[model samples]
Target: MTINTTHNCTEPQSNWIFVGVYSMVFMVGLILNLTALVVFFCYTKLWSHTTVYMINLAIADLLLVLTLPLRIYYHLGMHGLSQVLCEGVGLVLLVNMYGSIFLLTCMCFDRCVAVCFPMSCRVREGRKKAPLVCLGVWGLTIGASLPIYISKRSKASKEIQVDRCFGSFPVYATQTTAVASTLTVGFGIPLVVMLVCSWALIHAITRSAVAQTDLINSGKIQRMIATSLVIFLACFLPYHGTLALLYVHREAVPCSLLSVYHYSLMVACLNAILDPLAYYFTTETFRRKVDMDAMTRMFPLNSQNSEGNNSRAPVNT
Candidate 1:
């Protein structure tokens, strides 16, 4: 698969829209994710299985946000950067993207099992294995993303007076295989798992009298599920949809479609910005650490405690 360099391509005025969106996402995502990390490490107890997955998810979002400035620089006409640097940034982005996906999937599974089998010894045992699961997720994501670096072969173009990263691939097989694997492993399987877990969790909560009695906790879990579904649909769905389409029409894709692909990628980056909301809604510790008084003042009705309750409760999910 030969990679086409956009170095000589003229930038349309609309390209700046991407730059602007990235800038906003970088700033907001950076602040929110870092604050979540600080709260998780310094304030919240970190021993829970869900907390382990949440910590890893926050770290993944943080790593991805850290790469935005370079991307912004690239978007702002700073071309001719080292191919190795470009590939490294691409690799980090890919790893973090899938890392977030898999971690969220784990979280859904954890919550489902907890809700469905609260007293099961297996749930307790799973807590001991949480760290290993996280380690495995990191390893899997890194291993999968390594192909981005290995398959990308950069070369200096004397005519353009710069080193072009991902200039071209020697074989289409690598590109085709990578895209297929990513669609299945990175998005498809995870999507299915999340949907199943969410359904099971909701069903368990509805059928169990204990879950109905704890309205506040149940509400938080439902919010978390809704947020996860929205993020996947808004961010990953369109982007991967475009990827599949591009793969199908690789030989005759229009420039407008290419532009749509770029926009879809930008939309996907919004996931970093939205993940912090997941932390807030799902993690009671995070909610306690944050200033709920101010949040309540900002959004009074939505933030109100149930039944005019004055006592603030932590999320127990």
Candidate 2:
């Protein structure tokens, strides 16, 4: 397999933008996900079927964030990183990206089932298998991403004196197949499932005439679903969309489109930063774990009680 040397054009402006955005995302995502991990592990009461998925999601995001510095180094024109190291980071990135998607999809389905069949015996039984389901997602994402290392054979170029990683994949076959599979499994299927689940959840909530408790629960579910959908759209959709275009066009893809594709990837990285908000709103334990008084003190206001009350506004578990 040969690299598409024609598409190796560099954009310093875009590279700097990536470095800046990734640095910010790394700092924020790392802190938020680590806090979530602490809450999930230390607060034993927070353990539940849903928290299993949340824990795995946090782990995936944390791992993905840990890879950002390497990517930042790569984008900043630093060379000589081994091909194995490059591909390894790429593998982790894809694994977590799809892993988060699958986990979020599972969450949506879980919430939908809970809302639609609140009293079903089968639903209760199904909750017991949440750990197994998460394990399967991990296995599936790892299996899918392993091809990143397998499909490309890197070689050190005498002219450049550095090894090329994914840049060397055969465009028409391996690259095309990878992009197609990524679009289908990573984005297309998950998007469809999430949309269906969201609609069902909304319908179930709206059609039922329920008490204030149920209303609040429904509102929380809607917020979680909406946040997940927004992240999917804003992050994954544009990145994958541009990715497909780049793959289809190959060397003919313009530098401007390439810049857009790179920026879209950075936007996708923002999902790691936004996911903690979903956790904060959707998980009662997380909300309770938050220090409202500390928050009010950190960002001072005239009236601490009022600010604390506003911060503690009701959210569903």
Candidate 3:
């Protein structure tokens, strides 16, 4: 199913563009995710379901950001770079982008259950299940990306130039199917899940005295939802949309559209930076930054974690 097109088109250069973009993502994403990790480990005393998800999300973002240095190396016209390294870099980025989305969706779902169905068996049991879910998400995203790894291989072949590591790779029919499936499950379904979970959380917050009369908790919840949706749409939407177009009409691609596709990738990487905004909203990190009696409380802390960190806030329930 590998199809090679012989038509010559001047591929728009993206070396400088990715250089600027990856540098910014590396610096900002590193600082934010690291701060988040410290707060999760040091400041937070309880390991609630939401904390489990957010901590793992931070790790995913951290690992993803870590890959940018190598990306910068490859983009700097290093001809002697190992093709295996390039492929590994590509695989890491792929897993991070989709894995973060899956984890973010889990966060939303956890909140929804905590707020909307606090007394249900699901919420009570979620603490045990959250870690397993995170493991499953990483496993699934990596497994799903195998076909893409095979297709997007940048090894120097007769058709591929040694200078090209990021793009100008072969696209096979299986790769097309992989991309389509990723769009459906990776972005589309997660988008739907977040919206539904967000709606449920917001509705619960408004109806109940979520913080037992702290109106600001409502605002925090709303802001968390807003950040997640905004990041997902503004960052991921265009990247996936352009990918859809590229695959749909991969043959005879106009230079303009292909350029758009390349740049969309830069925009998509912004999630690594902006995602900390969601962390600030959803976790005790923001409230703990200021003087707050209870942290991350959609509800009060439960009996289990209520012992440690007199300030440790219970997840909303």
Candidate 4:
């Protein structure tokens, strides 16, 4: 089970399974994300802070999914990509991966503000500044990923012939620095902030209905945010954790930690599939669309006008 370090990676028994699973996940993610993009463009009026942020999230998922075909081909056929090509593709995917995480964290924070103190939250609706924020996320992602290009290890090690990819750090210092920075700045801090804010939102939402006008709506949104954060944690924690361990125990690189590392990488790819689900779950408009679809299914002949009147009628009376 000696893991090669160059581009001529030996096909592990698990590589077959990895390719099959990741292929399905990426395809589904691609479709869902594209749908989200269409929704964003076609229904701009329905866009709120959540939906606005979600549009960027969908972009991230789409970009990440786009890179999966290369990976699938490489794994399935043991194709050797040039070092420059591997590094370029890997950097782009890496940016989206972290960009999505950070952006979600930002959205969670924004939602927390809106939920806990709507009067003071002060987020401008329609978010004309959204493009700026997105630009910043991309800039930061590229800035953070610059080290990969500089280090040259992002390309496969010439001696071992196993394409190292992004997480397979060749140098101990570089691996440690990357893992520590990402874990602390990218994941750890964001997770902590989201946990605190989400708990506060829950507390605020559960208070007396009369005391909180938006309690019900806020509760739904908070649950969605919390769930997304939980998925992010579950997916990326193992990948970063094992990578951290790999840094400390470099001797375990290709052989000792290979399986764990590879599995972690697979889980990371699976995030693309789960991320769109998280976005839809966190979005009010998406839920409303789903409810409308369900209603249409339940009453195929009901007119929109009739449904509106029925919705407005007092249920308690």
Candidate 5:
């Protein structure tokens, strides 16, 4: 295989900065996703529709995190790596990125259904959809990413000789189509669906009788919606936003612009960390420990003569 040199790349040292970013994402994401999976499996009460999607999401995050070391190597210079490993890295990135997106979207949808269609939520048949959706997501994302094989092979900058895998592909008609279709399916569709579900969740919560009296429950619903939206907006939007910009540049994008895209991409990986934290907030067993009653029961000395009424948060499971 011939080595392709890109004179367009000048900032080789900048890769070190990105290495730090990827390293941080890997460490935090690994810890958070592992802890979430452990808690989900250990606690029987956590077996629910939402938990099903969450388990898949944690799996996706863990896999995504595991791949970061390869990305770190990509940034740190692989010294002419194998084309297969380079392509495999890109494939794993695509599958897990969109897999997590779909899983998180599923989670938001589950919450919406629980709030708006509680009867369906209680149904045994309805509960089975979660795992089925998880399976479909894994299949679909992997299938969607098969196109990566058609993309060009890895190339390194002549200045750095740092092999860049899945760095910036030259914009061509096929690549353009790929970017358009991926953005629409991977990010655009899920984003719209999540926003709609989140709105519906908020709307349903406000209209319900529980809204008038069950302040804690209502608050939980709000928190879930807020956190989900924040994760999508903060963690995903910037990367895809930069992707769209790259798409617009057409044919050839500036090396400097490619560097910016890489940075935004790393920032987007923080979702692996953020999503697990959301799990702690939204999961019933995890969230309930914060209630005054749970606190009083666990630490009696701290709650002596507490002023307000002891309104134990309702158990969801």
Candidate 6:
């Protein structure tokens, strides 16, 4: 049950590089997520199912970014803060991280359902169950992360010559609960749902497309979903898998496990950067929403029209 304290990565290259990269990411993510919030709220009436899921995802991302300052300070050698503050920030960050994963999983399922059975989607549209399901996701996410706040404590270590906050119980407490919760709430349940939904969606789409041959020709949609699943499996699976292994064999794990842990942690951070690409490409609505702006920025309508006969002819044709 005894947990060994490990030093944070302190190589000058890694430290400065992570600091710079995450700082820029924080700034851009903060601005973009804030804009998403504005779109969610100011244009509530204009929202649909995709927007609802995206708004929640953006909120979680925003909260995660908000906690980055404390992490940045810690990484930058501001260890003077009380252990309580450190644990507090860690708790919030963990919640948002897992919450985001689950939310995205939920969104994938929602998309699968909508694509696979449009008629059923419309049938369920006005039902109270739809909103309730979203509410359940939030509630479950909060419940899953509650262990971080509840079991967290600061301990002074004469052996390691450091005072730091850790989970209250290493054996049956913090680490165990975190892994179990993540496996169930963060990984097991959501992944199963996502796979099933996605499978159904793909099957239905393929079948319907072959039958009608003209209904859904957008390979982009399929590509988007496939890309999302690939990224999710690549980035998150390793991280969680490593974490689970660590939780199970924490005391006697080999150095290789620690290496995998570090690598997976780095990959997990890539999720934040990769997500914007996913959002941009997955939702056609998002593309259409920005089309006008993109066109204006790239080439003015008047200028295109002034090109004469070329304007009357279709650009693609």
Top candidate by lDDT: 2
lDDT of 5 by residue, 56-138 (tens): 98899899889888778877865566645765776787679889999888877777777678776355467678888899999
Q: Which stretches of candidate 6 lie over 4 Å from their true place?
A: 1-14, 121-128, 152-161, 164-174, 210-215, 253-263, 291-317
Model 1 agreement with the true structure over 37-128: per-residue lDDT tens digits:
76666555435777788789889988988888877877776666786686677678768988999998888888778877879997879866
Give the per-residue lDDT of model 3 (tens digit) for 1-98: 22335234455333877888899999999988987776667656676777788789889999999989877776665556665666677678868988
Q: How close is candidate 3 to the true structure, as a TM-score?
A: 0.80
What are the TM-scores, per candidate, against the unseen true structure? 0.81, 0.81, 0.80, 0.77, 0.79, 0.75
**lDDT, residue 314, candidate 5:** 29
The Cα local distance difference test for each model comes to 0.71, 0.72, 0.71, 0.67, 0.71, 0.60
Better of 1 and 5 by TM-score: 1
Off by over 4 Å in 2: 1-7, 154-174, 211-221, 292-316
Per candidate, the number of residue pairs that clash is 5, 0, 3, 7, 0, 0
lDDT of 6 by residue, 132-167 (tens): 666777787677666555644423322343333221
Evaluate model 1: give its lDDT.
0.71
| lDDT string, candidate 2, 108-134, tens digits | 788779888999999989977999999
Candidate 1: which stretches are off by over 4 Å?
Answer: 1-14, 152-174, 211-220, 292-316
lDDT score, candidate 3, position 268: 79
Candidate 3 lDDT for residue 80: 64
RMSD of 2: 5.4
- The per-prediction CA RMSD against the true structure, in angstroms, equals 6.0, 5.4, 6.7, 5.8, 6.6, 6.3
294, model 6: CA deviation in Å? 10
